[model samples]
Target chain A: MTNVSAELDSRFRAAAAEEGLLDVAYDVVDSPLGELFVGISDRGLCVISYEADPDAQVERLARGFGSRVLRSTRPVDPARRQLDEYFEGKRKRFDLDVDLRLARDFGRTVLEELGRVPFGEVTTYGELAARAGKPRAARAVGTIMNRNPVPIVLPCHRVVGANGSLVGYAGGLERKHQLLRLEGALLA
Target chain B: MEPVRIPPFETFYEEHKDPVFAHLRRLLGQGAEDAFQETFLRALRAYPELRNGRHLRAWVFTIATRVAIDETRRRRPMASPWLHELAVEDGLPPHAELGHLTDNLPPKERAAVVLRYGFDLPYDEIAAALGSSEDAARQATSSGVRRLRERSKRS
Candidate 1:
């Protein structure tokens, strides 16, 4: 039997993309914080998970987006490059488009505000809630931060406790501290 | 019994793609590439709703067979008789020897024979793939085999 051709594989992917069936294309990239599972949709970059289990991450993406998630580097290459630059301190702001479909309502609003916090700056959850037009929803904002899908790109680590203590990062406090220090937001 | 966990679509695709392609190649020959893509596309579209991954191989083969049937039906009206005659005179293409033998069979019979003999799938699985009774699947396979035997004898 003849081996399956590489040409056919790419053609299928193109056809799937054209039909909007290739909902998410993902790849893993090495970082100072270990491997980052980066996922992108045609809409934009959607998921940057710090989860250890790759299978669970893919399953979550399949459930959130459609099940047409494929392991291809092409769609995620730009985000990976930007992340590499950010880690190396060569870039401050992300130029790539982000897909925040995974976060909805107030959570989405909070993340949108978080994106504007800039490099090396920190905001309290209460302040972020006010920025999102809900001064009394600070604890709710904390819940949103704990569930932030696109973490580092949206800079969820920059949100600290009310007393300026490092707190409440889904990727863990150590990684958050490292991220803040990397951005010169925290004095090491 | 434990419930079967459906794997991620990527894992499912990697496991079944080559076998499904080989099955389509035996039935559709050069047209297998298109059918292969169609099979996976359909599979991916419906993958999340699948509650059971126990028969995923058979499930994909069913999609491949239906795609092959559609492709053959689409091509029959446009295919020239002389083109087929010339192909016969020139001998069958290397990757398509089985395809040539089964080309004249009814689509379901061709699929039945291929699934039964080539892939060693049971009559029940073949029935499921062909959407027929298991007895009918067995008859289709035997009749397809007999027809191929007579054709080879005459040649």
Candidate 2:
């Protein structure tokens, strides 16, 4: 992005927003853990990240989406609003549109199964892999969960260890436990 | 003529955003972003019909300058003081701050000066962008420059 006047950049953003030409528009929203960058494609919310480095994401999105990505708040507004509600314990299920184009094949299959885990429900990685028709591929399920493009909305945090221990989360185990606790999956 | 092959909008955006944005910022004062948006919006709308790839840069600049000038007319019937305070603290380029430079001149002269010196547009291209004769564009730029010099000296 060149150093255009802030006003012009905003105007450009507004028009892109109006036309829905922003291939991947994103904005940062605050959560109890930290700031999260929420991105959306025209179809639905696409990517969420713990890191908000614009330059790196811009390059990454350009390569992935084949268009310019901008920091448009409007497209991701619903995602932000819903995430806010979920984090606040006011909402249990997310009804936002999701673009899962970034997920492929087994990863896509694994995520779809994970999305069905429901709020306040817990499933083991092996259970998730079995639902995706690859019971022995529990490790693969874990890998897919780690790279889940849209995390909380997909409910990867609901996937616990096969032994029912809190194992791993892309956002860290503490966040995973917190999310489960918020959902009443954990007594504490 | 067969339509010139324009890259996808995302590719175009990645490739040209900086130059186009920098150009609009230099041409317009405060709300250059709006102009940048409008310019690209119009360009994208007409991109399919653009016949010559070689003229893309100049073409984008043409739309940018016009959008910028049009924005000047649409918003800000009266200049605000916030831009004034920002300009006074100008540690960088004097004209780069914009509010003072934009307020001091009429819209046409401002466009001419911004295109000429700010963007280094030749008189012919500036005239094309301004929808006037080259000679008139040259005169407008000259007068706009003289006013800026006098204002700076007084300040």
Candidate 3:
């Protein structure tokens, strides 16, 4: 290896040594949008940032895990593997446990409501708020979505604007459109 | 640089997945998945233009690099020790002589060399990927190799 490569590898190894602290599990899942980053904990899938802003999301994740989050990539990441299967349409349901500790109360509540949004169908922002027992909080639902720690797993994209228009997806509206289309939820 | 046609999303993933992931992993250092996801998302949003397939790799790299650099600016974690070690090894004489001199450059230069040498891209492509001019990309890669040669001679 060249001197620069050697030095880079050394730093990488040093970071890898801290792997013991990062028990966070990860995987790459196939999505209608393409390959995606899916991370899980014992509770459920914790992080589901799209491919582009993965590190930004990782930094956000570190706040939840504290210093235990390490920097590394593993193809064998269970979450990624399962997600791959999921997007390939081979796996209809995910069995991975996720860490929900990072979710705030409203966020958790919104996510739970989102989970009820059966696959192959879609819901509205207001409808989701009503399901969450916050009928007046339709816009708050949008805020909850902006803060959603997990997207596809929680199915946040399944929720649309009150007017039934596709709007405000954190993962990008086109992805939201595509995911909805893939699940056969996009209305003509 | 050639114009790149954005293939059907599914087709794009199947054909370019490995190289794209490899690029993202290398560019972002860590958190490659997020960069990878973001890259496709951006592509999804701006699909019609990424035609021609000629500069497709460079285009993808450009997005990944921007996303990674943005993340780095936001979250500046120390490089992993392994990364440091790899950088050091790349500076050694044996590596330089092998023309494997590509490995240990600074992260940005390393990225440029990898895209240029490993992928056989032209300087324009590398510059586009890096959001710099061809001259800048050339300078970065040249300087990076020059430094490697200097370090190799000393070692």
Candidate 4:
């Protein structure tokens, strides 16, 4: 689905925050996968890490967003609700604004191609590599997916081994299988 | 001067809520909650202008003072005509202890005491917030403290 939300209008921002001039705000949200650390930049959702270490993630966010980050749920509630809906099989698409500044050059290009891989479908790393305009950079595509800042929402789990088998997943293969099974992409 | 980076509104709230809330609570008596909320809303609207990031705590308290005064102005006229609008205040009792301590002071003097002693705001900042000379701010606080002591001795 198309990304949703433009500028958070003054009215919404005013109610959502006290200062309303933060560089970024983040909070830990409950997911089917456990607690997910979500960060929303002033622009949009910028970081969603599979890594659950909030301190490290906060450090990284400070480095990226310059320590203007605080834990506020208002900006992140929409993203969290959509994720909940997805895991419950009620949503096939994420209609949320995403800021991809962290992903860059080859990695960013790879994620854009990964978005086209679609829901309830699977594709090969080598295939996605070619789609990213690198005929032989299958391993590089793997690296890109591995480092994906925004994972499940971006459908990184949809990429598999060339043998058409589920391969590595940052969230672990079990979660990957769980997602694929939920999506009905895998058959028992 | 190099621009000081401002944190997210959430973070700022976490760091500053206690002092700001306490300051507003003492000033507005029954309307403290409304004043507290409005102060932050006004601060949110003015955030971009504070990107320079000098004395943010004092700046916020300054905003809270303005909000408290504005709340007083709002409540004065509607006190009798619209009693139902005052229902929320009925639910949450004004902090009777602190309210009694400074209840006799005028709004400006109450603000001066709350800012100076309650929040430890400096004269210059308090004056800026009250739109008066620093000496006037000090006088207000002195007058406020003197009245509070007289009320305490008589009781």
Task: Return the top candidate by lDDT.
Answer: 1
Answer with 3 or 4, whichever has the higher lDDT.
4
Name the 10 consecutive residues with the lowest summed lDDT in model 1 chain B. Answer: B80-89
Q: For residues A70-103, could you state the per-residue lDDT of candidate 3 as single tens digits?
A: 3335522666666667676676556666567866
What pairs collide in candidate 1? none
How well is each residue in B23-124 modelled by candidate 3, as lDDT tens digits? 656655566666665665565445444446565666667666656555654554343222343345454323322323443567678766555543456787
Ranking by TM-score: 1, 2, 4, 3
Estimate the TM-score of every prediction. 0.72, 0.65, 0.47, 0.64
Clashes of each: 0, 8, 85, 3
The reply for model 3, stretches above 4 Å from the true place, is A1-20, A23-35, A42-44, A51-54, A72-76, B1-155
Superposition error at A37 for model 4 (Å): 2.9
User: For every candidate structure, what is the RMSD over all alpha carbons to the true structure, in angstroms?
Assistant: 6.6, 11.5, 15.5, 11.0
lDDT string, candidate 2, A1-188, tens digits: 35655565566766777896667887888998688878888888888887766666666765677444667667777888899999999998899888888789999989888888989999999999999999999998889999898888999989989778988999888889888999999998
Interface DockQ per candidate: 0.43, 0.21, 0.02, 0.13
**lDDT (Cα, tens digit) per residue for candidate 1, span B85-107:** 32343343323355566788987
Highest DockQ: which candidate?
A: 1
Instruction: Tell me the docking grade of candidate 2.
Output: incorrect
Which structure is stronger by TM-score: 3 or 4? 4
Candidate 2: list runs displaced more than 4 Å. Answer: A1-8, B1-34, B43-155
The CAPRI category of model 3 is: incorrect
Task: Supply fnat for every model shown.
Answer: 0.55, 0.43, 0.00, 0.20
